[model samples]
Target: MMRTRFAPSPNGPLHLGHAYAALVAHDTARARGGSFALRIEDIDGERSRAELVEEFLLDLQWLGLEWDGAPIFQSHRLPGYAAAGERLKAMDVLYPCNCTRAEIAAAATKFGPDGPVYPGTCRNRHVDPTGAAWRLDTGRAMALTGPLEWVDEIAGRRDATPMIFGDVVLLRKDLPASYHLAATLDDAADGVTLVTRGMDLFPASHIHRLLQALLDLPVPTWLHHPLLVEPDGRKLAKRRGSPSLGDCRRAGEDGRAIATALREGRFPAGISLSQGIHQTP
Candidate 1:
């Protein structure tokens, strides 16, 4: 059976951007006769709030986006993330570094293209004796020898390659799991075959695809829908306060009106969404 999820971080109120994404995910899974899962990505413990989490759930429900199963919280899955990290660490694919933001900035200025990109300066040597964070080793360019190809339901044929993202951090010393690690692991755990997300996440697909390889997990078929952009061409942020579905509901905006307004104001060209976008098996 096909399964998909809309994983959103509960750092703030659910704005129009959240509404659009939820609608897309719900509509997609329903049209496909698949299971829809709600995945709460409150990975950032410091920033994520329970109040915001409740609001997110209520907002998604208000937007008419119901799910088939109970929600999965990444914050609660620390052991899973840690286990995955251990597996990679044992393979000598990860190393520790003590570089801070300021130090990394300075290094970026001194180093070139991929050089500034973490540089793996701390990979071979102990740059800092203490306060080190873990990093993925990309010193020797990661190569994947396989017929790696997945059909994107929206964008079509995405030929995945390991060299695309090189090495990516699965966990931080401070945080249990990074976004890439938790997300990929959750998909594997939930048996999610279809992944529906915003276009902004497309570039990061390479990283997740690589994680799937390293962990021997099934790579979920991707569908990168267009982001909910504003008139100024900037993507909607929670701070913008464009009014969430719940907010609009309180303000007397019917579901039909909200949908029509979004189609008219935010998305022109009538938004050709995938009712049942099939992927190549």
Candidate 2:
């Protein structure tokens, strides 16, 4: 049986974009007679709020989406991430990186898909494994995996090009794992068959594919749907003042009606779908 998941971070209240993604994931699995799971990606360390997790659950319940089994929290899976990192460390493909964001930005000359690629300043430097962030040596990793590809239900087949993000971080100094490492590992661990997410994450799939190859994990198909955008052509984001689902609910808007509209591709006033795939920063 196919399994899918709707993983959300509890750093803030759920928004319209999140609702759209969750509904799509839930409905898609149901349409396939498959199982749908909800995962709390609270891997953001101190930034993730416990209260927001309850709000997220309530919002999903209001939308009439039900998930199978108990939700998995990333915070509770630290040991698994550590084990995966240890495997990578044993493979000698992982290297400790101590460079800060500003330092890399200042040193990087050319831009790649995921912003200015890391200049590999600390690529050769040795540091305490537990104290420094670990980065995948993209060049060596590509050489190890050779040519690879993953299929998207919408975008079709894509060549794996993780190097576009340069040597991406797998584990952080303060956190047990980076998004790239944890999400990929968890998807495989949960036996997710289809990954439904926004088009903005299309590029990140390349890295995930590579991780699957390196970790010897199961590969899942992808579906990168268009993002919910405003009239100004900007994607809805909390930082940009996008209203939360709670805000809409408090104003007496019917949650079921909103969910139905989203499923039908109808959006609120000034909100539409964006077709562009975005670069991760």
User: Residue 165 of model 2: what lDDT?
Assistant: 86
Q: What would the per-residue lDDT of candidate 2 be over residues 119-203, giving only the tens digit for each residue?
A: 8887787676657789999998889899999989987888887878899999888888998999999999899999999898889
- Top model by TM-score, which number? 2
lDDT for predicted candidate 1 compared with the true structure: 0.70
lDDT of 1 by residue, 81-192 (tens): 8888889878777777777767776765343223345545677885552445667775332443244566577677876653444345566767788887888899999888
lDDT for model 2, on a 0 to 1 scale? Answer: 0.90
The TM-score, computed over Cα atoms with residue i paired to residue i, of candidate 2 is 0.96
Give the clashing residue pairs of candidate 2, or none: none
Candidate 1 clashes between residue pairs 3 or more apart in a chain or in different chains: none
Count clashes in each candidate, considering only residues at least 3 apart in sequence or on different chains: 0, 0
lDDT, model 1, position 184? 85
Give candidate 2 misplaced runs (Cα > 4 Å).
128-130, 278-281
